[model samples]
Target: MDGDYVIGGVFSFHYYMHTVKHNYTTMPEPLSCAGSINSRGLRFSRAMVFAIEQINNSTKLLPGIKLGYEIYDSCASVSVAVNVAFQLSGGLDPVFNTGDKCSQSGMVLAVVGASGSTRSISMSRIIGPFNIPQRVADVIRRSTAKVVVAFISTGDMKILLEELSRKPSPPRQWIGSESWVTDRDMLRFSFLAGAIGFGIEKSVIPGLRDFLLDLSPSKVADSPLLTMFWEEAFNCRLVKSEATDRSVCDGTEDIKTLRAHTLTHLISTSNH
Candidate 1:
């Protein structure tokens, strides 16, 4: 593996089943990627491939070094994420505390994403040790792991908080996604004070706004994903703010300069 940068990636693309007992469905076991890829997982994996291509094509970023990656699926489970994390830590396959515990040098220099927080937390215990940024990593054994949390939903936030609360550390500086920035339930957690979050980042994607406004199922008959997204844009799957909880899709929505991103709102607690 004559690679320069080993960027480890994690994505949850499928639903996980606990047991494959006669009643349960069958699928690949932990530490395996033999299962069929899901739509969401495909989307994420493609994005990463596109990004790596862009980075490789660019001469400015890496200079002479090539950028490479090792992407794994978390299967939407903490146990699965932990399994993926060890693969990222190095070549620790079929790893058990009791047998064949030899860890090899993995090809990754840094990790990219694990959309769910529980997965992120479970993996962090392993991902935290490996120093990213090869030049500095060459000399240091232990360094600050740069952790970024994005698209971590409210449910995952609760699990993350509960885990942290058990072994309460010093107040951590938190960076959050718009998803849970203003969640009232989370605000009640005293430990989350001073956490900062970013909302969606909006940009005029030249003609994209117009395209979305005019988008319809008939227009995108070739793509099923786009068709469903069209409905999502105008349909209220969940409760809408200050409005009746309608069970129908209203096509009267404005697709203007969409609030693509959000502004950060600091949590006000008794002590920062």
Candidate 2:
């Protein structure tokens, strides 16, 4: 960012919801998504970076546009997405909190993100600024020409459909992605119509399976991203000071003890 560049923002759910605990002593320790990391979602996030890098290199795409981006992890949570949006817009500084949500740096031309419907909606409200964020808790309405699209799980779709029903907004067209694009239960909802989505396109990624199987403690130790993933995978904290979970990592555990998502963990280092 030393020279002229077009900055964009990327938001994706790199973590999957695992569990919520109400057993905390206080107002429930918000350990957000169990601090879990989804290997598949990690890959999706990498894809966005790759695409942006490609556009910056391409002479035909945006001939004069030297595109760069700031990526944010939404944790697949609506509330978290709002914080991200506020950060992106600089309207609410995410860093400084003095009982007043404000920040000195919030700037972005556009945002290419939000994997889920709920997240996408949350982002649009903050970005579009029809002052829609005030009603996110109880109501969500839109007054725009473009239709709202969604790419969420079946359960999330149910919540989104219910929210849309409460408002007077017209039935907006949605373009679906691979997830829940053709869900049988989704077809039952009248809110989503003409929701065309690409079905599963199978392709054998050569050498990918082998690369994943080859990962070991020795290999992961060199990578900070992998090391963090390992700790999250095992539900342990490698750093003694940052240890929030009861279980502590001795740093001798094998990487195989964590679930292997070759596609997911591979791209994490690229960002780091």
User: Lowest-lDDT window of 10 residues in candidate 1?
Assistant: 263-272
Candidate RMSDs in Å, in order, are: 14.0, 9.8
Q: Which residue segments of model 2 deviate by more than 4 Å? A: 1-3, 6-33, 58-65, 91-106, 127-151, 154-198, 203-227, 233-272
- lDDT digits (tens) for residues 1-272 of candidate 2: 21134344434444444445456566743323434455545555546555666677789998876665555666676666766777667633433222221123337677776766677787888643232344341333545544656656544665566666665355557777666675565666675546777777555544434444465656666555456666666666655664364466665675454444533355333332
- After superposing candidate 1 on the true structure, give the runs of residues whose Cα lies further than 4 Å from its correct spot: 21-38, 92-105, 127-201, 204-272
**Top TM-score model:** 2
Clashes in model 2: which pairs?
39-264, 90-106, 93-102, 93-103
